[model samples]
Target: MTPQPFVAMKNIEKSFNGVPVLKSVTLEVEEGEIHALLGENGAGKSTLMNILGGVHQPDNGTILINGEEAKMADPRVSQEHGISFIHQELNMVSDLKVYENMFLGSELRNKFGFLAVEEMCRQTHEILAELGVNINPKEYVRNLATSYKQLIEISKALLHKSRLIIMDEPTTSLAEHEVNRLFELMKNLKKTGVSIIYISHKLKEIQAVCDRYTVLRDGQLVKTGMVENEDLETITKMMVGKAISQERFMHEHPFGETAMEVSGLTSTGHFKDIDFTVRKGEIVGFTGLAGDGRTELFESLFGFRKKYAGEVKINGQVVKIDHPRKALQAGIGYVPKDRKENAIIKDLSVIHNMSLSSMGNFERSGFIQDKKEREKFDVYKKALNIKVHNPRITIDKLSGGNQQKVIIAKWLEAETDILIFDNPTQGIDVGAKQEIYQQIIALSRLGKAIIILSSEAPEVLRICHTINVMYHGEITARFTGEGASEEEIMHYATGSKREGIAIG
Candidate 1:
């Protein structure tokens, strides 16, 4: 007799607006195992998960749980079936308190049916403590960092006590230590016979924690097997259909005169004494662990934060920019980190979002030129390989990676002389990352100054011509990108070493 898998979806077929998204894809998962769902952006991984999560229904499929056919009619039904989904874009209400967000739909009540605020707070604290996170349960969620918000979302899932949890890009905003703690908790949950369907583009993390793997590409199943049986290159090839090289990018064109230079740029309590120069035709990267203040420094430079003590020289002329409009007027364009919160206007159409920042480019005599706007968008869509069936659809309907591409296109259309991308590929896949890198490189070659801020050292190493490591709100070291190794970068990033030397 054959043992039945815990969950099985056989011959799943789905389409949206007559476009096939999942073509007879099949998947099976066993009890107490971490199953990885791997694929590039717009590869139907999310659509398949949405079907299982009850956000969408498959046109044709049979889902069996514990050898019994089950129908997930809605999100609540999926939760009732012991399934919990933590979506990639966070669902936290910024105005709510930590405990309130944690107990949103499933609030505790006393005998009289009054809200048991104290009891809810206590449970919230306990669950957060389990993840090595400590915060006042009454604190507003908007006051917390993105990393803490992500932890709160995870704790909310644990509160449900679900038999199966689907985590999508769960660690995208977490620090190294936080990621480690979460992995430990995941292993503990597995010991208690809880199953997890993990979806992430970080292949290394998948190899570390996942038991089995499934690959999907272009709305179809391509491979499925044990994680231990395949190397990263082979797995990457399955997801992207090509090899992705991790070598440093070589620049043939020489850097022009300094486009932007900063000295003693200090934002009180955020960053201090940040000094660097970005030349036309050069790509400079700033990298560090969480709380290292690289993001804050760049935010100040981009005029998102006004009260900063600094001297900023653009083309050797000192400029004061205390607002985003001023930053744009100064020929600076910024692609912020959090896409859902900071980058896109969810209700706007994809083409509108692309042209929102540079409305002048699509306007003629105080009127929007629809045909001109679409023609310009079509160029970027093809260049960036954006996977959108119709430009008229709302921006929120696109995948995270594709949303990021749209944001990038928005800046490119703005035609800024200097561009700043903070965590540019935060939720992007390996293949899409390569395309973005090539685009950045091409931009630099055309005499645009580029600044990249990323927590991943390897990312800066792979693309930048100059690298700066930050620790405790200061620049600890600077290295020519080609000569610096990841180990050396980590040494400064971790506050273990400091040096002020220029080398090529």
Candidate 2:
């Protein structure tokens, strides 16, 4: 006599290589509701979602769709059942055009069976407009920014008439305005009887958009309740098993002489008139909205962009770096964003990836010393709280947070005096994020000069010693991290204010 829920996964059990990832987990989603899946990085959230998306099969479970048992044998079968999964790591093909990537597997066709290019582009334009993104649908995906690519992924999900959409960290690369637009669109979708399984590490965004919450810890469901009834600290405690403080990190140690100084750094279309100095034991952060050129500016400094006008001094001595090798040789290390494409070699073992940048440390007699590498990796593994059953496994087998830890270990092993981290905690959970912040602070305490690039203003405010706000390829404001507020940062980030202070 009672109506059935739209979707249900009852008593799901899964394991990988004898390690239980999900233990008798159960979930239910009503029609047209936004249900948030919350957990720490390795807490089995992805494993559960993968099962629903048909990327993996559960060892034991009953998945019911509208009260009928549904066997999700493959991703295609899941798609047939009106499920759309927007993955955290983007799945876009760089070589394809925007519209082409949008309709890659499900292409529209004319009566003659030829590709309906015009229709596809028009539809792409229509969907992107809903997200306030304007791009040439015929343009190659490689040319677009990460934020635009993220929007395209969301648009792809909307293209399919999915009854339930599973979004994993959908707003990771989006700007403030763009994220607002997405929330609006999600609300509209919910109004049309569509359900969403929202997975995000950002607790505030979950509070903003999700209607209900489910917390998973150590591969088991710990709590499930309405979002309005619980506070963020309570939800965070459920996810991480402790309370996390939002206070700014205190640095009482005095900075040493400038480790890196930039004067009049300019790249024609990327950034202009950039001037800053990072001293030993200093943490400097640059933040802004999407397309603000913060990433490009740092990419140039790291030698990824060769053509730039600047005077760069490392340890008070001028240097020229035109390649990544030269940057490394200059004692400048970079941990780039987009870990899948730039940070990790998926096929390589976890220990090898950790030692990739500093192979010399593990080499003797022209041969790599596996024992030495593993020994060094063990130190970082424990310090970073990396969860890995075996170091011999490929780096791709680790969770995203663990992969990021490996990348950080690679740079630390290199012993670079100057370090740059772009979106360091992009996809990591709150607890893992706190650990990374402490690591960065520890590195600074050890006299390493650190530069961080983040789109989130609050992140910079939390850890950096100095905060620089960028807008339209220019540094619009500079404030001491302790004195800066999110409101003031947004004012400069949006190009509504312009003020600069001398950086020493």
The models' CA-based lDDT, in order, is: 0.91, 0.90
Off by over 4 Å in 1: 501-504
lDDT for residue 338 in candidate 2, whole number 0-100? 75
In terms of lDDT, model 2 sits at 0.90
Off by over 4 Å in 2: 502-504
> Residue-wise lDDT of candidate 1 within 283-327, one digit each (tens)?
999999989998888878878889999799999999998888888
Predicted candidate 2 versus true structure: per-residue lDDT over 301-383, tens digit per residue = 98898999989998888999889888888899999987767788989999989998788888999999988888889988887
Count backbone overlaps in model 2.
0
Error of 1 at 253 (Å): 1.1
